[model samples]
Target chain A: MNEDKKIGILDEKTYSNQIHLIGRVGSALLLMFMLGIPFVIGTVYDCMPKFSWLIQPSIALLAMMGPTSVSEVLGYAPVLGSGNYIAFITGNIMNLKLPAAISAHALAGVQPNTPEGDAVGTMAIAISSIITVIICAIGVLVFIPMQPILTSAAFKTASNYLVHALMGSMILNTFGKGKGKTVIKNKLMLPLVAIAMSVAGVLLIPKFSSYQGYAMLVAIVITIGWAYLLYKKGVVKVVNRDEK
Target chain B: MSYLDIANSGLTYTLVAVALSVMLGLCVVFYVKTRKRALELGISKEVLNKVNRSTILFTIVPSLTIVVGLFAMSAMIGTAWSWFRLSVVGSVSYELMAAQTTVASLDIADTATADGSVFVAVMFVMSIGALVGPTLSAILTKPVTQNLQKAGAQNNGFSPIMNACFMLAIMSVIIPIRVSTGGLVGLMVILTAVLLSMLIDKIASKGVAWLGQFNMPICLLVGMLSSLVWAKLLG
Candidate 1:
């Protein structure tokens, strides 16, 4: 391990380069697989969809999901760091990947957007993805037998609240104490204002519900502006330590 | 084979299995490679192991929830497509909405009566609609990370503040949705989770270090399980 560390120190840049290269290649291949699956199924089943059939729903979904997709990438990439590649491929960004990354960083005693944080985030995402795949695979295998139990009203109700529970825990853990509290203290007004604005937007103007998709984006923009004001006012202290 | 036969055929099952295998294989490969790089960065083995273990623990509930989602989708599409699509990209809700849109567009009474061509179209649209995130991430992550790093370099607090704002923004949107939709039971779960998390953090701060590792998962389980009680009382 000592010898490995010596080599690691000597070749840190090379290692980073390798990771970047591999990630790009892996992502490209995964993209092909994603696209390829439908095509392969179409061919083997001898059921080609007409262009119009493809275009109509595609346009509808793209219209609905396009902006949010853009926002998620822009918003989450920074927090995810190197884990962006894996997280994006595996899906479940907001609920699974982001929470896992944040939780892992907290557990590892690292702050986000740092080398240690990035490393920990990447490892956490990888493990989380693996576990998700395993569990989903098992679920698929037993889905026939388990359908009644899994789809039960009691289980369904609990499952519906799962995200609430997960996000509640995540918010508390991520912003509960220490550095998180410090950051929150300095910028508490931002979230409060954003939350108020979101509630007002979603509730007061029912017609504006069409634009409800942009709620997160709007809140983020508002919070970023408020944070900037705090930064300029020197209310929030930016701490930059040397990379360990 | 007819449309229904094709949909439920051995061939379709084989293809789904192969696709799943490839997906899982890619994840494993990525995990091994990334873990190696992390190790190369000199992260301690102990830290990596702990993170890995805790992450798996944290993921169980959410992953099972996704399974429930998969079951819901299986009602629309068949089991193979539901499993494959949810495993690959898009949440259950997103895929279900896309599938519904296609079904409506085709004017099919139900997914069961839909022909193979209709199923293919549904799958195609679902896959394409969900591609934007991963595709954009693959294209934009490097530049985004670079810009964030540059900003952080100029302002020591930029990255941390930005991260906090991002997280808060997400929570701000989600919490309201949960509150309004989840009702009394949901509210109870959220409050339970928040309070439990605070207690755990307090305990961890008092020197029970191991508890810190399990804090989020513990709170999550308590919150989810207690929802049953809340449900019963509210009902």
Candidate 2:
């Protein structure tokens, strides 16, 4: 909201376009590399599987993954900004990259959609991606000595609970106010979340657990629509802290 | 060759190394791009550095799940492939699902019987299936991010509220599935995290400057660790 602190208009699009190019090129390269691994095994190692074996499963998996890919990219892209490229490539969007980007912006006292927030998000995601690669490398290097601990019951339990833990902490940020300075007043906010969760608990999870990204995508659309309704109702007041 | 032989071979490790190197290179590229823009946007070096430090700390605990994924997939596939997949375009859920498809179809009881056919099936399926999200993301992210921000700026005062409501709504959907599937331990983890998060916010609000950086990490660790206690007592 600080005009003096924001990117000036002479080449205002400089940051967005530069990041777009980076994201585009980076994405294309990653795709090649990702697909290349399978090609390498097929050609060099001479270990191609029967095409027939893949026929049934490939269709099934694609049917599932296709929608998932669309939903995740569509849902996460707007929020992720320039960081989307690295985030999607590096994966762990829900569990790591998304939260990392959001928190980075919040902790730095930046807004969601500005150049500052986008840049900080990209940087935060990059830092996060690097750490995961290093950790996995370490995990690979020390697998023998670390086998028991990695496979332990306690470790499994904690890993299963990690996402919930992250979600719980992050949800607090939305309820009132933190970095964004603006908030959806709790009058409408409380009923909105409670009803949405009740619907999800009743309708989505039990039926579509395997298809969570898609289900989440649906929830997002409905939430946005409902928010729009609230917007029209004139009940969703968001007075900026500076203006106040 | 035996499945384990190919799965854990020297070449396999080398492939993973090369892939990992490429990912790291991309990360560096992204880091530099954003850092430059952040500076131009009048963000201070001190704040940027704080962002970096905070992000690194925030990432570590959540990355426990990634570590867990690596171990889980390594058992089904191999360490090198597991490492590679988890590093690039692979999630714990997606990788496991893909691997399980190969396992069930091939009836792969153990590493010994998982032949070249099984390995090939696994890799191809995992690689190809995992490509969807990132591939589309590559094509669509810029337009999406740019347009969304543009819309927000053009709109009058509603965008932030919409964003806040959306954030909360997304959490509403996620929390139930996660907690429901998680059973009692999930609820306990969330309760612990919420309390800790509130405490951090309260203290930070009271002018504890540096404490902000550790908020998410502290909450994540205690929340996750609390699961062990909940499971022990309740299970």
Candidate 3:
């Protein structure tokens, strides 16, 4: 019943094996680093918090982050692939890494969900991650001198708009016809579904921000489910869709 | 030692440096490996060059914005910790929230004078709590990506549609929430960005080769600039 029945892309060699091995191991190591930092600080200062104190904040953190973890993996995996490892590690997925990968693919005139696309995505992320680390280091070195420009009200206000602005421009790139052609025929279906879901979210969820993660998961299922349904119904046709 | 002193300690700085160096080193390895593979796949050198150029240009503003976050958060979390955290799954919002939660649980007034226990606890909460996403990604990304690839490999067009939907799913939730909460400036910023992106795309389609490559950053800048206009108008 799945329309995505495997076909012949015989010429293409799979690139997932090595990338996954590195990705999994690297992520595990990075997690250790994350934990290690605290442990080291605690040891040096001998100031580790009591176990009893952790219970309250852990619960609160779990409530917010649990859904987010699941949602991010589900939504981002399809686009990011092995790049997920570094992208997740680097931790600026929506704003920096994702846009970087997507933009790289777009510039190269490559299609997503393909081997070439995945490689380019990974490459872009690596480049961006490297750049980010370098920039952060530089920022730290100059933190004192740049304090005024960085903390200015105008700068702070503009910073608030960064995500909004970035996402808006990104919509056209992702949803609309930013490049030559896309696979979907009825391109509007998913976006409309997504918008409707958002409107419903706004009307229904009084505290939308706190529940954004849950809403995100719900939206993913609804929008993808809607797209799949339309695909099954033949309402959305695939064009230039060469699986090979 | 004082909170600031502990946060800025040489030990903290050294640990952060080593971790980041490892990460940076890994990026180099991955990039080199992926680059070789890309060439093997017959992607032209010229195109790869374009990707490099485009990526560097596109990344600057976003990365600097993160530093802006770093600047704000460093005051609270300290420079080294802020750098390490932002470079690894750390967001200003998450960092701020984690700090507040840690303080609240410890019954502290602020991060500056909080005990070493409080600082360490804040560190733990920040990392361990946010591990869900990256941890899941590490375990599940390969299989998920393979499945999507397999599905796309099938002659059917469902896979690409699936990919598009995933992005839509994310954008749907994130964009609306921002617009709704952002009020007038939020609304204007989003609208301006959408319009500007569309305009740029139109121009790119007309053969401005360089413009097409840099469209995202351009739209983002213009979009952020539009917020200032809205802010001034309202004032």
- Per-candidate local distance difference test: 0.75, 0.76, 0.79
Q: After superposition, how far is residue B41 of candidate 3 from its true place, in Å?
A: 2.8
Per-residue CA lDDT of candidate 2, range A1-244, in tens?
4675364643567767877887878788777877677677766678888887676666778888898789878877766778889988888888888888877877777656666778888899999999989888887777778778867888888877888888777766645466655544543453364445545555644554566666666666777677777777876667666653
Encode model 1's per-residue lDDT on A40-85: one tens digit a residue: 8788878888988878888888888888778777777767877888
DockQ: which is higher, 1 or 3? 3
Minimum summed lDDT over a 10-residue window in model 3 chain B is located at B151-160
Candidate 2: segments with Cα more than 4 A from true spot = A1-10, A180-205, A240-244, B106-111
Tens digits of lDDT, candidate 3, B151-213: 766766787777667667777788888878788887888888888877877887688766776
Rank candidates, DockQ, best first. Answer: 3, 2, 1
How do the predictions measure up, each by TM-score?
A: 0.88, 0.91, 0.91
Model 3 regions more than 4 Å off: A1-14, A178-183, A240-244
